[model samples]
Target: MKKMKALIVAAAALSLSALLLAGCGGAPANDKKAEDKAPAKEEKTTLVVGLDNAYPPYGFIGDDGNLTGFDIDLATEVAERNGWDLELEAIDWDAKDALLNQGTINCIWNGFTMEGREGKYAFSKPYMHNEQVVVVKADSGIDSLEGLAGKNVMTQVDSAALDVLEDEEGQKALADTFAGGAAQTIGDYNNAFMQLESGTVDAVACDLSIADYQMAAKPDMFVKLEPLSTENYAVGFAKDGDQAMVDAVNKTLKEMYDDGTIAELCEKWGEYGITIDNWVLVD
Candidate 1:
């Protein structure tokens, strides 16, 4: 009987050891399986671009009621190159600064002018050229800057034209001739042209590209006056934005330019007078 009890005790001890070993050995495998089933870390890959969609050949609502333009196409390419998704935010032109400052938009990719706005925001390399010009009714009898004297003149709010009228020294003399005592600021070019067509305003000071588009779309209604001031277009970021982001955009733009993508897009928008022949990536 003593031998039998001792053998049974020994067998129990071995079984206990096996159970402990098995418990220890199985822990790591179970933990690895659990870890493998865990969800992956999600990364952000969406870029929100801000623009005055009312501005055509850059960004505008198409006849199909969809957003389409030169800037939109360029931005789509940039997003694709980075494996990111593009979200177009058609914003009020006058509120662009507010949008950027509040983090509502990632960047302004419209035909945004960079001259005279130094230190206001981080800028990408100038990618295109633009000129400010005045548009008047074909028979309004205003053919020159001098003809604008004592006439009701208007420009879109927060536009390069308004900036020139408000700040540039050489243009101040001409800006002072508006019939309203100062150049009136409209919400958008559409409104400015409406006021012009209705004879409420004598002329609309706007970008040369936009003027050309407007005139082409309504040939007999308006004609472009001589350019008021030449400027360059660049992407605008917040003043405190990440420089790395701007650098990334500049790099991509240069790549596009070198690969002839920029030229191709210019050709696509050539009817609107958009050109990139003078564009050399500003270092």
Candidate 2:
């Protein structure tokens, strides 16, 4: 009787141990199966685009007090097509290099000139052609670049027009004949126009597109002289930054051009000289 009781106890202990081990082993498999059935959370990419908000037809504050322009619209579309979250960062035009270097912004997209800055930034393919021109009041009688000589001319600081005026071999000879022997620099075009209106400056040197917008906004107020230099407009990325992003932008621009999205935008901003004729997408 003692042996039978002992054997029965041993059998019960072995069965309990087997059942516990089986339960422990099965729990992990069930947990793993449940884990496998769960959907993975997708990560999204955010593209931060830096631009001069005051630059009209490209990026600017409309009467609605919101950022809206050609580049803004183009960047928004690019972000949407790439499944990226878009962030438009308004930055000081002169401090663009620092912002790009610090990664505060991804790229400079507001009417950025790529002709003279090819070595400084990783530029996307040129999307449009631009010209640096001088603007004077209609009655100022500055019908040609020659008339700008010996005048108090002004241009935006760090702008392509200024660059042309500063280039010793370029339009610097013409700029040297100005009132101060050089073109005066300002922070923005609006201020330059204000100074021109107040007769503080004789003429304003700027991009033709900007001049066109200003002329249309205030008819019979300004006249654009001959072009100082012709250049191309492109997105400026940090030279050492993401080339992948530049390539992506280039691809998107090409796609936009093919699908007539760019043309539509040009039509919308036609008053600023942003037309399909200006678009020069090579490859």
Best by TM-score: 2
- List model 1 lDDT by residue over 87-169, tens digit each: 89999877888999998997999989999997999999888888999999999988898899999899988889998887757
Q: How well does candidate 2 score on lDDT at residue 201? A: 98
TM-score of 1: 0.84
| Candidate 1 pairs with clashing backbones | none
Q: For candidate 2, write residues 123-194 as lDDT tens digits.
A: 989988999999999999788888887899999999999999999878999998999899999988889999
Shift of residue 256 alpha carbon in model 1, Å: 1.1
Flag regions of model 1 displaced more than 4 Å: 1-42
- What TM-score would every model get versus the actual structure? 0.84, 0.86
lDDT of 1 at 172: 81
Q: For candidate 2, list the clashing residue pairs, or say none.
A: none
